[model samples]
Target: MVEAQHKKELERQLWNIANTLRGNMSADEFRDYILGFIFYKYLSERMEQYADDLLKPDNLTYRQLTTDQQTILDDIKQESVDYLGYFLLPNELFEVLAEKGKNGEFILDDLGEVLRHIEQSTMGSASEDDFNGLFSDIDLTSNRLGKNPNERNQIISKVFEHLNEIQFLLDDTEIDVLGDAYEYLIGQFASGAGKKAGEFYTPPMVSKLLAKLVTAGKTRLRDVYDPTCGSGSLLLRVAKEVGVDNVGYFYGQEKNPSTYNLARMNMILHGVHYRSFDIQQDDTLERPAHSAKRMEAVVANPPFSANWSAAEQFKTDDRFSDYGKLAPSSKADFAFVQHMLSHLADDGTMAVVLPHGVLFRGAAEGHIRRYLLETKNWLDAVIGLPTNIFYGTSIPTCVLVFKKQRPQADNVLFIDASQHFTKASNQNYLQDDDVERIFNAYTARQNHDKYAYVASLNEIADNDYNLNIPRYVDTFEEEEQIDLNAVASQIQQLDKDMIDIDKTIADFCAELNIKAPF
Candidate 1:
């Protein structure tokens, strides 16, 4: 419990550091720089700690080692590069740079070069792809920091001072204090970043739900994937549900370069080795990064109703070729589903968050929905979520669970969890109980009057394959009968009381020698 409190305090302090750059630029711009700096700090601290542990027997710290001892330094560099996937010199450590900045030494240049060296250290190594361009978003010369270089240096130094004071405890043996705090800071940025947040951040509760759904009844997953990975929070959440060691590998793709970088940092910060995760930058639908292998569990919270080319050439693509119709160019909700579906292993369970329209929308989407329900019989469940649960949009959304193989292929489960959420600020969120109830009902595959229902394939066919939640779960409430006679009698008595009160007021006004006020 004390650790829990300390974690919260750490998260608070990390978020406070953002204030130093809050007004210098837009939230999106500042978020990139702040998060990049935090990533750098994490990397630096890890490097120094690892090197110190290796040098302990010699009664020498990495910081105190002499420059002439090239042989020892070279051995340490090889080991660090092999184990940590990067190398950092003692002079390039985070504490060294923070002290330099505190002493009013211009560090904007050295800081930039240090970040570059961290990335360059991984060259000719397996982690090169993972660490390459990781720090590309941090531009020290951006005029937005200030009108001149000194102003920019001063503000950056202030930020470094703020971050240097915190003890991240980068250890993962016990509670993941720094990792959870990192997640909290990312959420804070996502919430304030507006629509852009949707591009990279899925609300934690929502990610938790998706993670639980996909990982249910599984002790280990050979591989987990997210096509529109964003900040890779959803992918990490899945690892949390399944033990990290139990998860074989993490795979994801992001279209935004900056968000792609964040995903890599998030993975490393969570203590996932560079070899354990493969995060690529590119549009998943157009150029899938991980198309060759089928994932053991697939989860994604894709952009709602996002536009895509939907060109004729895509019909021949393997991911979409199986589906008879391409999703309309205007809305690619089902397109993403098809892309993920194509990569889902036959034994895997897939869950995705999509807007409600996919449930009943006709035309091309209807054709794709019909294929999944009727022809393939892969549609396992449809769970409706509350509105305003996402960062940007307030539209009602639902989770679609699918499986290539199912024990009970004759029916589909439906859960209406829209009303079972707590109101907080401007958003509504599901409590832990709410999520468990949904997961339990899904696992039980039982009928719940107003919460869950198991519908036969025929029943779904009767409704023309519309997986809308309301069609299965009946949440309609009946209003009480009105007492018109009692109400009318009360009104009559109130009329007499009004007359008495008016007469009393008139008498008082007359006694005061003033006309009675109506």
Candidate 2:
């Protein structure tokens, strides 16, 4: 409980700093700035701690080093690059900048240089790919920050001062809380980013569900992957399902440069070592940074019905060649499925969230659906979700679970959970109970009236391979078995009461010397 309170306070303090200092910038815009600064603060503290540990044998602390200690600093720099993947001088640490800002000194130029130095520190190192352009989204010269340079400096300095007031206690084991705080900020920013949120963030509940589905029955994973990694939330979520050490590595690809930077920060912030994650910045479908790699678990929440090139050249591509058809260029839902499936290890499990249309949409999508059932029989389960749970779109969606070597090879589990969510003023959400219920139903794999059903392969094929949730899990309710006799009795009573009310009005009209026209 104390830990929970600390986390709550940390998130509140960080969010307040973000909002109070952002002026009129959009949520996503300020998101880039605030998160960037917070990341810098985290790195500074980590560097100091690691350096202190290295100096312990000499009975010294990092802050005790003097300018004359060049040899010591050089030794520290080489080791830091190998272990922490970056280096910072005592003069360039986040604490020094915050102290300068607090002392009413201009540090914008210094701050920019420090951020650049951080990027350059990893040059030619194994971590270069992870650190390159990590700070590109933080454009210090943008006018959106303030009317002039001095004003920009003042606002940023204040942000630093406020952030410095909070101690993340990085040395504590709850360092995970710091990572959680970062995710909290991302989720908070996503709440206001509207439809654009889908581009970089998936709702926490959905990410958890997908993670659980993919990592089911496995204590450890060889590796996990997410092609549409976004801020790398889903990939990290998968690791949390099992202990982090249990997962060997993380592989992901994303297209948005700004969000790509955020993903790398998120991975490092979450304690995922640089050597453990290979996040590439590019279109997953077109480039597929990890095309030659296969993973033991795969998860994705690709853009709903997004458009893709669907070039004829892709038909012969290894990922798509076997399908005999491509998801239409207009709706790439099935296209993403085939891409993920291509990366699934023979014994791997894959779970993806997609629009409901993928279930019943005809044409190329229909052909692909048939091939999965008739040819591969890889689809394992279909679970419906409530609409409006997503930040951007209100369309209802479904989770499709696939396994190449399924023990239950004869049937598929269908769960209709569309109505199981808590409705808020602007959005509906899944309570823990709701997520657990769906997961339980998924594991049980039995028929429950109006909720879940296990349909045979023959039954699915008889319906022309349509996997729509409603087709198998019937949730139709007979309208409360309306009692006509009771309704008629109430109407009759209302008629009598109306007559009496009319008589009373007539009497009042007569007393006022007005005509009772009735």
Candidate 3:
């Protein structure tokens, strides 16, 4: 209970800071600034802790050391770069800047310089790529912040002042307080981002389901990959399922530049060492970054039915070559699937979220589906998801799990979890029970009335390679039979009662010597 309250308080504080920029900029722009400031503070706190530990032997503190002690400062900087993959001078620390702001001093230039120095410190090092341009999205010179330089500095300082009040608890090993808070802020931003949210963030529940699906029956993974990694959430979710160290490495590719930076920051803030993750900014379909690497577990929530070049020449590319035809130029759902399949190891499991159209859409997609089921037999299971579960779109989606080596090659599991979700304000969400029921059905691969089915390969082929959920999982409800005879009896009884009442009325009229209109 204490931890829960702490988390809520931290989230409230961060969101309050985020709203400070609301009047001056858009959600996406302010999001970059607020998160960037938080990341800067996180780095500063980490550096302070590390320096304090190292200085303990010298009976001196980092803040006490002056530039006159050049040799000692150089030694510490060297050590910091080796351990933290970046270096920040005492003056460059976040606290110092906040203090200067409190003293009514200008700090915009210094803050920008410090951020640049952090990136530069990783130069010619193993973590260079990971730290490069990590703060590029936080544009300090943008007119959106203010019309003049002083206004910009004031805004930045106010953000720092608010962030300075929160303690990240870097020394506390038992809790990931800051990391959880960071994720909460990211989720909050995604909620308000609308359709743009789909570009970089996956709903946490969906991420959990995908992670659980891929990591099932396994305690460790050689590596995991996401072809269209968005903020690396799905990749990170896989790590949480098992011990983080159990996953040998993390690999992902995102096309968006700003989201690419966020993914890197998220990794570092989550305590993932820079050396353990490789995130690239490039089109995963057109220019695969980790093409040579085979992933033991892969997951993705690619854009639904996004357009791609689908050039004819891609037919010969290794990722889509064997399919004999490219996915439609207007819809690239199958293209992402094929890309992920190419990197899946022989013993790998991959789960990807795609539109329902991929299940039954004909032409090139149908050919690809038939090839996966009949020719290659890599398709393993299909799980239908609820509609409006995502941030922006309301279309229903499905998760497709594939494996190169299947225990039962002749059967494919189908689970219709569409009806099992709780309706929240403006959206549907999968409760824990809902997720578990689907997972249990997936693992058992048995028939369940109106929920799950295990269809034979022959059955799928008979249906002409349509993997639509309704065809396999019967969720139809039959209406109860009506009782016509009982209804007729009740009608006749009512009519008899009305006739007796009319006769009684006629007798009363005769006693009164008045004519009855009946």
Off by over 4 Å in 3: 492-518
- lDDT score, candidate 2: 0.93
Write candidate 1's Cα lDDT for 195-222 as tens digits: 8899999999888999999998898999
Q: Order the candidates by lDDT, highest first — what do you get?
A: 2, 1, 3
Candidate 3, residues 221-300: lDDT per residue as tens digits? 99999988888888888998997779899999999999999999988888888878999999988888987899999999
Residue-level error in angstroms, candidate 3, position 77 = 1.8
How does candidate 1 score on lDDT?
A: 0.91
- For model 1 the local lDDT of residue 389 reads 92
Give the residue spans of candidate 1 off by over 4 A.
495-518
- Hey, what RMSD does candidate 3 come out at? 2.6
TM-score of each: 0.95, 0.95, 0.95
Put down candidate 2 lDDT per residue, 124-201, tens digits, no spaces.
999999999999999998898898999999999999999998877556666788888899999999999998899999
| lDDT scores of the candidates, listed in order | 0.91, 0.93, 0.90
